[model samples]
Target: MKLKLIRQTGIHVILAAGGALMLLPVIWMIATSFKEPESIYAFPPEWLPHPFTWSNYVETLTRPGMAFLDFFRNSMTVTVLAMIGNIASSTVVAFAFARLRWRGRDALFVVLLTTMMLPQHVTMIPVFVLFKYLGWIDTYKPLVVPAFFGAPLYIFILRQFMLTLPRSLDEAARLDGAGNFTLLTRIMLPLSKPALATVAVFAFRAHWNDFMGPLIYLNSSEKFTLAIGLHMFHGQYGTEWGPMMAAATLTVLPMVILFLIAQRYFIQGMAMSGLKE
Candidate 1:
């Protein structure tokens, strides 16, 4: 009993230490955001600001040519469009893979999985060229349009989740005179809320934080998303640490709120999706 108690205590201590390590950066960022510029880099590295200031947030939000509200609106538009496209496309593709049987289905699945192994950089140039030819550059089309085709990872995840669902459900729908479209819409989609939420959350976050895509495709400053706006805050000679931290905090708020809202569904879908056939 004593030995077991000692081992448990040791495990708790290790876990606490690991938790602190993970939280340290977040703590530092918050601390720095509130500190005055003079005290930001003070010796001994203060964990809490001596005299906290809210000016950073105000300045960050009100900065010239950075229009926080506009950037936020752009981010939200892109995120919402991407989420809709991903959900619609992933659902149909995953349903096909999970419920429909055809020649070369397994081979096609293997090919889909193989694409995941290829680095995004390899295909980025070709994608850029295609978008350029279509006159999609300098517009949101490059970011929003591709999502309608479904992402390979999201399709795979939803397919895995769908596979775990009982075939009896599909049979019942079929007996009710439901065709493929009816079954997919009336049955599969309703039952796959958790998986769909997971896909939506992921796609929203991806497009929300995407800097490179927006930078390459959107030349107009007014159309820039939050990620691009953040990058522009850093000048060539010096960086505005306070405003930068404030903007970083603001940028993360939406993701945090979203995760808090959909975290349960996300975890549940991931857990159930791994069930073996």
Candidate 2:
């Protein structure tokens, strides 16, 4: 009993130390956001500012050209739209792969999986050019449209989760004259909440922090999302570390809240996805 307790205590200490190391930067950012601009650069560095200045957040939200509200609205719209697209498309594709029997299904799945092996950086330029040709530049289309087609990773994850479910449920549904769509909506979706939540969380986070796609596609400042807008806080002469950190803290809050709310599902989905035939 003593040995087991010692082992568990050691594991927890390691985890606690790792967590603190990972969070140090975030903690520093938050702390710095509360410091006066001058104090932010103090030689010794202050872990806690004596006088906390909340004005950095106020300025960050109200600054011109930053258009923080517009950026927030735009990002929320894009993230929500992308989440819906990812969930709907991923669920449908996963259904086909998990339950349906079709010709060359496994081979086609292999091809789909192969696309995941290709680094996104390799295709980024080509995709940008394609979007430019389609006149999709300066629009949300580049950000939200492709999600409807389904991301290979999301599809694979959902498929794996679906595979872990009992086949008997699908068979039972079919015997009751339930169609594919009905089975998907009535049975699979309800049972796959964890997987769906996992996909939604990922999709939300991806587009929320997407700088490259927005930078390449959105030409106008008004159309810029939060990620791109935050970049403007850094001037060519000097960066506003205080306000920038303030803005970053605000930008991260939604994602943090979302993960906290859906964390259970995220872990459950990850576990289910690892189940094999």
Candidate 1 TM-score versus the reference: 0.92
Question: Which prediction has the highest TM-score against the true structure?
Answer: 1
TM-score of 2: 0.91
lDDT tens digits, residue span 1-277, model 2:
9999999999999999999999999899899889897789888898986588898889887877778889899999998998899889988999999999999999999998888778789889899899889999999999999999988878988898788899999889989999999999999989988778788777888889888888888879888788887776665214778888898888887878888898886676567546533
How does residue 7 of candidate 2 score in lDDT? 100
* Model 1 clashing residue pairs (backbone): none
- Tens digits of per-residue lDDT, candidate 1, 38-119, equal 8887786778877999988998887788787788899999989988998899899989999999998999999888886778
| Least well predicted 10-residue stretch by lDDT in candidate 2 | 268-277
True-structure RMSD, every candidate: 2.2, 2.2
TM-score per candidate, in order? 0.92, 0.91
**Model 2 error, position 216 (Å):** 0.5
C-alpha local distance difference test of each model: 0.84, 0.86
Model 1 lDDT at residue 151? 87
Q: Report the lDDT of model 2 for residue 44.
A: 88
